[model samples]
Each structure stands twice: as structure tokens, then as C-alpha cells.
Target: MFKNIKNDLPASVVVFFVALPLCLGIALASGAPLFSGLIAGIIGGIVVGGLSGSKIGVSGPAAGLAAIVLTAIGALGGFENFLVAVVLGGIIQLIFGFLKAGIIGYYFPSSVIKGMLTGIGIIIILKQIPHFFGYDPDPEGDWAFFQVDGENTFSEILNTVNNISPGATLVAVMGLSILLLWDKVLSKKGKIFQLIQGPLVAVAVGIIFFVLTQNSSYLSISSDHLVSVPIPEDTASFFGQFSLPNFAAITNPDVWVTAFTIALVASLETLLCVEATDKLDPEKNVTPTNRELLAQGTGNIISGLIGGLPITQVIVRSSANIQSGGKSKLSTIFHGFLLLVSVILIPKLLNMIPLSVLAAILFIVGYKLAKPALFVQMYKLGWKQFVPFAVTVFGIIFTDLLVGICLGLVVGVFIILLKSYQNSHFLHMEDVSNGKHKIKMTLAEEVTFFNKGAILKELDSLPRDTYLEINLLKTRYLDPDIIEILDNFSVKAKERNIDIQLLSKRGVIENPSSFTEFFRTRPKSKLSLS
Candidate 1:
């Protein structure tokens, strides 16, 4: 980790820039105190990042949990009460880790995972569009399709058209231009360019523009449109922001319910993010999921103790770290330190940076995650893979992250069932003799109820006066429903003047009196293939 400090330090700065607005915005959206988000960010970075097995994945106050936090805070009656739930949720997550439930992350299909990254990318792009144009109704980091402000994503974009701020638009365009130039041209020139990334330069340009245009009414960006970190008047007031959890709420059943909810949701979101981050990791390092859960649980416990919203491994910050060339966990830890120091020391300077600049940086991140080429690639994999991927993307866009993933999982499972049904058995026509067909049916390795319909269809469609051989010699296990199907089919075969040959490990039976009876009564006997 120390060996990559050169790469990690600059990357941490980029992640810190990305995390700052998000921390504040998520807190604003969650209806929690603004400082709470920062505390979570600080803890997520330093504590969770220290304990986590992931080298690249970063943790923070997640936008995914904002809605849950908002609801829980209200239901629990206050932020202090909500803190109790957060602490308990951490304990539950620790239990989850100890139980080794991290294997749950492996169960998510690759298509859905890709779709999630793409979906989140698209969400970031869509959500940032308004902020790019200086529309400030929604906070900087609110990524939900339906916002707490009563407007949806697209509606905000549309409203931004009418309420566009010339200053913001100018700054955004300049910010984007500077970023593009830095990425494409300037950054390749020398070590200096590489040391100073595109996002940092874009931010510098945004601040300079803000200062220069202060007197120009049309070009001056409003305070609301700028990055707003809570300014503490003094050290005491700053420390005053921290609140203690209400231990009295621990006895409340509703607190336990909320804690369980947070644990379940935060754990799930963290797992999903871990998957996404590993996919994004250039080195392809695999993070220990169980350890990540333990790390997150610990972080959440500390965060709750100090009046912060729940924390999760966040894809946005993680992706930023990767995109900005973060090589190890040091970047994650350094970013947390930056979050801590910046708030303590240079928050006033941070407040000068415009939101449009950050939006510009995120636009690039979003584009990389949901590149148009990825869609084409997924489509080429065929509908079996594409459908779930597409559904997950659309679901996340129209609904939310977890809902979209569930929808994708459903589609993925449906595809699996369809394939299983089709592959359950194979039919081969041997020859035609005396106007009669000899058909051999081979059962798959494992036959389940899903395969019953396909097998039944084939049995029912067989021509009359044919000799049918039912081969079960290769099948390791068969569902009883399939055995019942064969039993019923034998009766129908006799009516159709079809002769039946049943071959199994129990030997051959020609015109067996009863299929079920033969299987039940016959002892295992090896039959020669010859």
C-alpha cells in the first residue's frame, strides 16, 4: 500500500473532491444534519478502508441508503433515535460477516452486475445534467429517479431548460472543456500534467471563473449552485455538530426493526458495490466479501456512535478512485483524511469550487461506466444474457438500484429455467422400417419439474406405431414427476400401438407391464452396451 503512495495520493485527492459534494448532498437528501454525511464519509474512508480487504473499493455515505435513512429518521422520531438503529444495524452486519454470508455476492449474475454499473453510470449522467446547467432544486448528490423535492429525474432536466443559469452553464461548459483537454492533451505532456488531474484543473478553473464573474449578474454562479460545505464559525461549533446516539431507543422494537432494515439493506448495497468495484478494478483484485462486511459493520458502528448516517461501499467514489489511477487502499484512507482535514481547515476554500465542475468530472465517470459500446457487446451475447442486462439498466433508471437488480435477477432466473426446460432431454430418430419409426430419447443429467413439460411434449408428439426407447442409463438423478410422466406416457403409447423399450441401470425391459412398478421392483443390474 505504501509503495503506491505516489499514485494513491493524487487519486485520493480526486476521490476526496468527488466524495465531498456527495457526502453533503446525501446528508441533505437523507434529512440528516449536513455534518453527519461528512462524518460517515470520514469513517467510511479511514475506518472501513483500513479494515476492508478491497484495495480499490471506497466506502462512504451511499445515495442508495438516503431514502431509507430519511424514512427511518422520521419513523424513529429523531436523528438521535435513528443513531441507535445505525449502531444496531452495524452489529447485525457483524453477525452477517461472522456467519460468512458474503457468499451472497457471488450469486448475482454477471449480466446483472454489468447492468448495475451501467445503470448507475446512466443515473449519474442523468442526475448531473441539471446541476451542469445550474438547476439547483435538487442537491448535488441525489441520484434517485424520484427525488425528495417532488420532481423526478427527467422533470428536473426539463425544468432546468427554463431555469438555466447562464453563469452555471458557462462554468460547466468550461469545466468540461478543461477536463477534456487535460485528459486528452495536457495530461500526456509531462509529469506536472499527470500529477494534476483533469478534475482538479476543472475545479480550479471553476473557482477562478466564480471569483472573476462575481460582479457580472448573468455570469455569476449563485451560492446555491456552488459546493456547500457547512461552515463552522469556530472549533467548538464544529465539534458541536457531533451527536450521541440515544441508548434509550435500544429498547424500542421499532429501533430494532429499523436496525435490521439498515443492516440488510446496507449489507446488500455494500456487497453489490464490492462486485461492481472488483469488476472496475484494473488489476482484477478480488476483495474478501466477508471482511468487507466486517469492515462496514465496524465503520457503521463508529459512525452511529458519532451521529452519522449508515455507510456502505460506494461505487461512485470507488470508481472515481480507479478512474483517477488509485492503486491501493492508501488512496481510500488518504481520501478520508482529506475529508477530515478539508472540513477542519479549508472548507471555505472548498465552498468556492462550483458544483458544475464536479458534475463535469462525474459525467466522464458516468460515460466510462455506461459506454455505448458496452450495450452493443451485451446485445451480441444474445437475449439470454442481454435481457437481464437490459432490464437491470432500465429498472435502475426507472426505479432504483435494488429494485432494478431484483428485476434483473428475475429475468436471469427465467432464462435459466427456459434453458433447463429445453435441454432436459434429447430425441434421436434411428430409422424407419416397415413404415414404423424407431425413436431413442436420452434424458439429461438432472431432470426436474421444469423439464417435465418439454419431455411431455415430445412424448405426446411421437407418431403412432413407432418403437420408442426411453434411455435413463446416463441420467444420474431424475425427478419423480418425470417418472410419473413416463408412466402415464407408456399407457398412452400402448393405445397408439407404440412399442416401448425402457433401458436403465436396472437392465432392459421390453413392453414393461408398468413403468413405475418395474422401477420400484427391479434391483440395480449393470447392462452391457453391446
Candidate 2:
């Protein structure tokens, strides 16, 4: 890790700049103390990053969990009581890690996951627009469609247009232009551009702009529009900001319920982020899922003990780290230290940076995540993949992350069922001769109750004096409902004067006495077509 310090140090600085405002923003969104988000960021980087098996994944307070945290805090009666739930949630996550439950991450469909990334990207872009324009009242990290401040996403943007800050607008435009140039032009020119990331340059320019325009009437950026890290007057005040969890709340039934909710949601969010970060890793390093859970659980435990929000593997920060050239966990660990040192030694300096500048940085991040090319790519994959992907994106944009993913999963499942129903069997009608029809039906490798309707339709349409052959040559598993459908179909066949032949791996049964009996009588060994 030390050998790569040259690479890791620069990457860590970029992540620190990226993470600073977000830490405060997520806290603001969660309705928790602004300092708590920084606490979580510090622990997530130092503790979780140190222990996690992932080389590139970054952990921190997640926007996805802000809604849950907000409700949990309110329901638990107080912030201290909510801290109890966070600690218990950490314990539950540790148990989950021990149980090897991280495999659940693998179950999410690629379409849903891609949709999630794209959805979050679009949300980031939309939510940042207001901040970019110097409308600072709504808070930074609140990306939900319906904000905690009672305004929706579009309303916030509209409101920003009405109350635009000239100073902030100028800073934001300059910051964005500098970032775009650094990324598109300067960064490619030499190693210096690579070493000093665009975000850092943009932030520096923002601070300089803030200082220079302090006395200007129209161009002055208000303190409200700047990055607001809790500045401690002294060591005592800094330490005083930390709150202890109320252990007595542990016995409360409501606390347990909240704990379980946090554990479940945080675990899920972490697993999803792990998968996403792995995808984003240029090295393609596969993170050990169970180990990641354990690391996150430990981080949450520590964070809660010191008045912090719940921690999870955050995709935004992780993606930012990856994009900034983070190559190892050292980058993650170093970012944590940066968070710690910045809050301690440079809190006032950090407060000087404009929120609009940070918004510009995230704009680039969001754009990368939800590139138009990706949408077109998904569309080209066909409706089966695209519908779920589109639904997930729309759901996330309109609702929240978890809801969007669930909606996408439902769409994805429906597509699977539709395909299964369509592919259950192939009906080939042979030439009709002498007032008789010959039809051959080949069953799919697996036939379920979903296929019954299509099969029944074909059987019902059979003409009188027809010769029908039902082939199960490739079938490996047949549902009982389908078997019953075929059994009932035989009676209809008899009424139509159709001669039925059932062919299986065992042998051909001509005019079977009972379709159910034929299948029941056959040994289990004969069921395999192989």
C-alpha cells in the first residue's frame, strides 16, 4: 500500500474533496446533526476501508438511506435513541456477514443494477441543479423526488431560478468550465493535470472567488451558500459535538424494530454498492461480499458510538474514487484521514468553498453514470432487458432507490414469465390429408403452470379425426399443473376423435389409459432426457 502512495495520495485528496460536502449534505437530508455525517465518513474510510476486502470500494453515509434514517430518527423519539438502533443494526450486519448472506447481492439483475446507477446519476444531476444555481435552502445531498423541505425536485429548480445568486452562479459556471476543461483538455495534456484533479482546481477557484467577491454587493456569495462544516471554536467544543448512544433504548421494542430495519436496509444497500463498485473498478477486482458486510457493520458500530449516521458502501463516492484513479484501499483509508484532519485543522478553510463548485464536480460524476450512450445501449438489448431497465430508472427518479429497484425486479420477473409462457412449447402443424390433421407439439426443457394456457389453447383448437403427438424429449422438469392440463386435455382429445401419442425418454405410450398414471408409473430415473 505504501508503494502506491504516489497514486493513492492524489486519489485520496480528490475523494476527500468529493466526500466533504456529501458528508454534510447527507446529514442534512437525514435530519441528523451535520457533524454525524462527517463522523460516519471518517469511520467508514478509516475503519471500514481498513478491514474491507475490496480494493476500490468506498464506504460512507449513503443518500439511499437518508429517508430511512429520517423516519427512524423521528420514530425512535430522539437522536440518542436512534444511535441505539444504529449500533444494534451494526450487530445484526455482523451476524449476517458471519452467515455468508452477502451472496444476495449476486441475485440482483444486471438490468436493475444498471438502472439503479443510471437513476442515481440522473437524480444527482437534477438535485444538484438548485445548488449549482445558488439556491441553498433545501440542503445539498437530498436527491429524492419529494424533498424533506416539502418541495419536489422540479419545484426546487424553479425556485432557484427565481432567487439566483450572482456570485454563486459565476463561481459555479467558472468551476464547471474549469472542471470540463481539466477533464477534456488539460488532464490529457500532462501528468500535472492528472495529479491535481479537476475538482480540487474547481474548489480552489471557488474559494478564491469567494474571498475576492466578499465585499461586492451583487457578487458576494452568502455564508449560507457555502460548504458548511461545523467549525469548532476549540478542542472542547469539537469534542462536545460528539454524542453518546443511549444503551437503555436497546430494551425498547421500537428500538429493536428500527435496528432490524436499518440492518436489513443498510446491508442491502451495501451489497448493491459492492456489486456496482466492482463493476466500476478498472482492475475488475471482485470484493468479498461477506467480508464487506463485516467491515461495514464494524464501521457502523463505531460511527454510532460517536454520534454518526449509519454507514454503507456508497456508490457515488466509490465511483468518484474510481474515476479519480483510486487503485487500492489505501486511497479509501487516506480519504478518511483527510476527513479527520480537515475537520480538525481546516474546518474554516473548508467552509470557504462554494457549494456550487461541488455541485459542478458532481454534475460530471452524474453525467458519467447516466450517459445517453448507456440508455441507447440498453435499448439495443431489446425490450426484455430495456423495459425493466427503463422502469427501474423511472422508478428511482420518481420515487427512491429501493422502490425503484423493487419495481424493476417486478418488471424483470414479468418479462421472464412472459418469455417462459411463449417458449413453453412449439406447435408444428403437419399437412392435412383425407380430412385429417397431424400436429406435433414439442415441450420445452421445463414446463410450468404458466405454460398451461398456451398449451390448452392449442389442444382445444385440434380438429376432429386429428392425429396428435406430444413430445417431451427435452423436458427435465414438468409442473404438476401442466401434467393435469395434459390429463384433462386427453378427455377433450377423445371427444374430438383425436388419436394421442405421448412420447418421453422412457418410451412411447399410445392411447394411454391415464396420462397421470403413465407419468406416476414411470420411475424417477426415466424422467431425465439425458
Candidate 3:
């Protein structure tokens, strides 16, 4: 892990910047103490990161869980009671780990996964546009469509146009220019640029701009548009932020229900993030999903004990880590330490950084995730894949992450069934024999119930005085339902004056009375093509 400290350090710095606002914003959204988000970030970074099998994934309080946490806190009576559910949730996740439930992530269709990545990218871009123009209406990191703020997503952008801050916008533009320059030109110039990342410089510039223009009437940035960390009066006050769970609440049935909900949702988000993160990883390393669940469980248990919000693997930070050249878990662990040390030692300094500058940084992250080229590429894969990908993208944009993914998955399954129905059998016309229509029908390999409609339709459409050949040579497995269809077809053949010939490696049968016996004699459930 230490082998790439040089790389990890810069990457960690970027992740630290990225994770900081998110921690505060998610807490604000969840209606938990501002400090609780920081606690979750610390634990997610150090404890979860230390144990996770992923090299590039970063764990923290997720915006996705903000609403759940908000409701759970209320439903459980208080934040203390909610903490009990969080701990129990962690335990349930551990149970999931032992049961190897991480495999659930693999079941999501590829098109859906890709759509998720692109959808998140689009959301990030859309959400940050207002902040980019210095229109900070609500706290940062609210990824939900309906925000605690009175406005929804698109309305916020319109609001930004009317309320753009000249000073903040200028600084954001400068910050963005610096990042693009560093990425395209300066970073390629030498090792120094690589050692010090563009985002770090942009943040520093933002801070300097904030400090220098404090007294200027026209160009001043205010506290409302800056990173907000809880300012403690002293060391004693700093430690006061930590809250212990109300273990007595465990007896409440609602607490148990909340716990199970958190466990299931958190695990699913983690698994999905794990898949997304691995795809973003430049090395293409596959994370051990089961191990990730165990690690997350442990992190949640610790977080709840200390009053932190629930945690999960977050794709935004993970993607930032990978894009910033993170090579190992060191970047993840180091960023946690940054959160710990900075919140304790230099929170005042951190608060000086402008949200506009951070928005500029996220602009880059978002653009990379939802590039226009990806749309064209997905379309080229054809409608079967493109429809799900497009639906997932739009779904996430319109709805939340989970709903979008579910919609995409449903569409993917429907497409699969439709394709199966169409490709189940191929009908070909051979030369007519004795003025009767001679048709050959070939079955596809691995026929299942999905294929029954197509097979039945072809068999039923046969004309009277037709000579038909059923070819089973290419079929590896036949469904019992399909066999029933063929059997009934055989009975109907005599009334229609249709002649039947069955062709397989088992040998040709002319006008076989029963399709069942002919198939059962050859193999069990599978046809013996060899």
C-alpha cells in the first residue's frame, strides 16, 4: 500500500477535498448533527478502507442515504435511537457477508450499470451548475431530486441564473481554468505538476481569493458560499460532538425494522458502488464483494457506537481517487486521516475554502462520468443494449439512483425475453415436394419457456398438405413446455394433411406419432447433438 505514497498522497488530497463537503452536506440533509457526517467519513475512510478489498474505493456517508437517515432518526425518536439501528444494520450486513450475498451485485445488467455511471455523472453536473455560478441555495451534496430547499433540481439552475454572484463566478472560472490547464498541459510538463494536483491549487486559489476580497464590496465571497465545518471553542467542545447510541431503543420493533432497512440498502449501495468503482479503476482490479460487506458492517458498527451516520462505498469519491491517480488503499486511508486531523487541527482553514471552487472541481468529475461520446457508443451496441442504458440514464435523472436502476433492470429483462422469443426458431422454405409446401424449422440451442410462443406460432401456421421437417440437431436442451407444443402439433398434423419428419443425430423419424417418446429415448432433458 505504501509503494505508491507519492501517487496516493496527491490522490488522497483530492479525495479529501471531494469527501469534505459531501460529509457535511449529507449530514445536513439527514438532519443529524453536522459532526456525525465527519465521524462517518473518518470511520469509512480508515476502518472500512483498511478492511475493504477494493484498491480504489472510498467509503463515507452517502447522499443516497440522507433521506433514509432523516426518516430513521425521526422514526426511532432521536439521533441516539437511530444510532442503535445503524449498529444493528452493520451486524445484519455482516450476516449478509457470511452468506456471500455480495454476489447480488453481479446480477445487475451491464447496460444498467453503465447507465448508472452516466446518470450519476449527469446529476453531478446538473446539481453543481448553480454552485458553479455561486448560487448556493441549499447545503452541498443533496443528490435527491426533491431537496430540503424549496426548489427541485431544474428550478435550482434557473434560480442560479437570476442570482449569480459575480465574485464567486469569477473565482470558479479561474479555478476551472487552472484545473484544465494542469490536466492538459502543466501536468504533462513535469513531475512537479504530478506531485501537486490541480484541484489542490484551485482550492488554495479559492481560499486566497476569499481572504483577499473579504472587505471588497464588489468581489467578496461570504460564509454562505464556503465550506462549513463545526467550529469548536476548545478541545473539550470538539469531543462533545460525539453521541452514544441509546441501546435501550433496541427493544423497539421500529428500531429493528430500521436496522434491517439500513443493512439491506447500505449493502446494495456498497455492492453497486463496488462494481462501479472497479470499472473506474485504471488497473481493472476486481474487488472481493463479500469482504467489502464485512468491512462495511464493522465500520457501521463503530460509526453507530460513536454517533456517525451510516456508511457505504461512494462512487463519486472513488472515481475521484482513480481519476487523480490513486493506486492503492493508502489513498483511502490517508484521506480519512486528513478528515480527522483537519477537523481537529485546521477546520478554520478548511472553512476558508470556497464552495464555488469545489463546484469547479466537481464539474470536471461530472463531465468525465457522463461524456457525450458514451451515448453514441451505447447506441452503436444496438437497441437491445441501448434502450436499457438510455432508460437507466433518464430514470436516474428523473428519479433517484435505486429507482433508475430498477427501471433499467426491468427493461433489460423484457428485452432479453423478447429477443429469446424472436430467436427461438428459424423457419426456412426448401424446394416444394409434390406441390406441397416443404418447410424446415430449426430450433435454437437451450430452448426455454420463453421460446414457447414463437415455436407454437410457427407450428400452428403450417398449411394443409404441407411437408414439414423439424430439425433438432443444433438444440442442446429442450423445454418440456415446447415438447408439449410439438406433441399437440403432431395430432393436428393428421387433420391438416401435414406430413412430419423429425431430424436429429438420434436418426430420422418419418411422421413420428409422439414427439415426447422420440426425445426421451435420445437423452434426459438435453438433446444429444453429438
lDDT of each: 0.92, 0.90, 0.92
**For residues 189-271, what per-residue lDDT tens digits would candidate 2 score against the true structure?**
99898888888888999999999999999999998888899989988999999999999888899999988989999999899
When sorted by lDDT, best at the front, the candidate numbers are 3, 1, 2
Can you tell me which runs of candidate 2 are displaced by over 4 Å? 432-435, 523-530
Residue 36 of model 1: what lDDT?
Answer: 96
lDDT for predicted candidate 3 compared with the true structure:
0.92
Residues 412-475 of candidate 1 have per-residue lDDT tens digits of 9999999999999899998797678999999998999999889999999998999988888888
Superposed by TM-score, candidate 1 places the C-alpha of residue 390 at a distance from the truth, in angstroms, of 1.2
Residue 88 in model 3: shift from native, Å? Answer: 1.3
Each prediction's TM-score against the native? 0.96, 0.96, 0.96
Q: Where's the lowest-lDDT run of ten residues in candidate 2?
A: 521-530
- For candidate 3, what is the TM-score? 0.96
